[model samples]
Target: MTGCGRREPIVTIDGPAGAGKSSAARELARRLGFRLLDTGAMYRGLAWAVQQAGIPPEDGAPLRDLLERTTVELAGDRVLVNGRDVTAEIRTPAIGELTSVLTALDPVRDKLTPLQRALAAAGGVVLEGRDTGSVVCPDADVKFYLDADIETRARRRRGELAARGVDVGLDRVREEVLRRDRQDMARSLAPLVRPPGAVLVDSTSLGPEAVLRRLLEEVERVRCCTPP
Candidate 1:
């Protein structure tokens, strides 16, 4: 994935919740010297704004109105909505649930999809989200559908919450993970699917370093095959 005199490739990593897409995307971007686009954070930022404005989650009118006036910015690791920092605020289980629900809405996707594309327009970017490959960047140079066993994913989610000092039981976390998967797959608009031409990476037993190595290998393989 060297840039040199050619355009850098756009890489997309898409998968269900707790599949380690975020961590891998960040590290892969760092290793490749490309910008990391956390599309999930954009939705979370909107969810935080919706909560603050008391906008009903299922109500389209108010949500649309709020989105019309909203500005979600992903600056490094921080997420800002309407010029206010919300990176930490939107990471809770509650906000995550709300984000899943809000993302199923047409108004929300219509509002954010273009922003996501524009951000990756320059080509040197790694985008991670539920639909980054299937919907947001279907023509991305390299796309990966990273997944793990449900049990592994649930444990990962629980560990992440515990690290945040939010202590949650494994059973409860597992249920939440399952619920999110159902919602994501059942959504009418842009349901989570492994896009055409995407390489599937099962990371049930692989560590972060191993996953990064595999992703880098695939990227390099593509780079070699592509004409400059």
Candidate 2:
């Protein structure tokens, strides 16, 4: 729907892993002339930092402390972890698997919520993450919750990871996806769940083109109605 109360337009695309959130967000951003924010990548950067600092995934205090001294700067597709470019480094399965844990933490969510808000508030933006609509920018003009079957998402994840040269079988990828679902949905602060009034688009049967077309239709309606 239309933005209830905002001077600028913001689109929040939130979904679980491998649900085409990133690709859809990118396409929507280009179509809408909005900046793109891959919030999951931000969490991946935090997970990489925690791992580098020898902090256990469950140690919230240390992870929060480590994050306090670190800065996550998103410069386009480049995710800067403490001023270092580790965008490609954090895409590994090991890092991706651990990132759900980081995103589950209240401390981590507390740290990044402000950053996510500031970026969206600056101007028009299409942000993709678990809680983009629900937590990060609930007041966004359009909220989309993309989804697909676990198997479909797993196959896509396997292809993506393998393309990046991390050879992993589809079976394991399915398991990893299921595990991520549990971890993401069970997370305390900001879980991977739907937001009220969000348009849920299932990509299981629809291709990206169809998804994009439908999304554009929805976004255009919102854009056209937003008060100046």
Best by TM-score: 1
Q: Cα lDDT of model 1 overall?
A: 0.91
Residue by residue across 1-228, what tens digits does model 2's lDDT show? 245455557888888888998888998898877899988888888989988998888755777678789899899889999899998899997897789877776788788889888888865788989898999888778899999999899999988898888998899999988988998898777778898879999999999999999899988887777777
Candidate 1: residue pairs that collide: none
Clash pairs, model 2 backbone: none
Q: All candidates' TM-scores?
A: 0.96, 0.94
Model 1 C-alpha lDDT per residue in residues 1-228, reported as the tens digit of each score: 333223688999999988899999999999999999999999999999999999799757788889889999999999999888888889999999999999988889998999998998788899999999889988899999999999999999999888888999999999999999999999898998988989999999999999999999998787777776
Cα error, candidate 2, residue 157 (Å): 0.6
Best by lDDT: 1
Residue 8, model 2: lDDT of: 51
Provide the global lDDT of candidate 2 against the true structure: 0.85
Instruction: List candidate 2 segments past 4 Å from native.
Output: 1-7, 59-61
lDDT of each: 0.91, 0.85
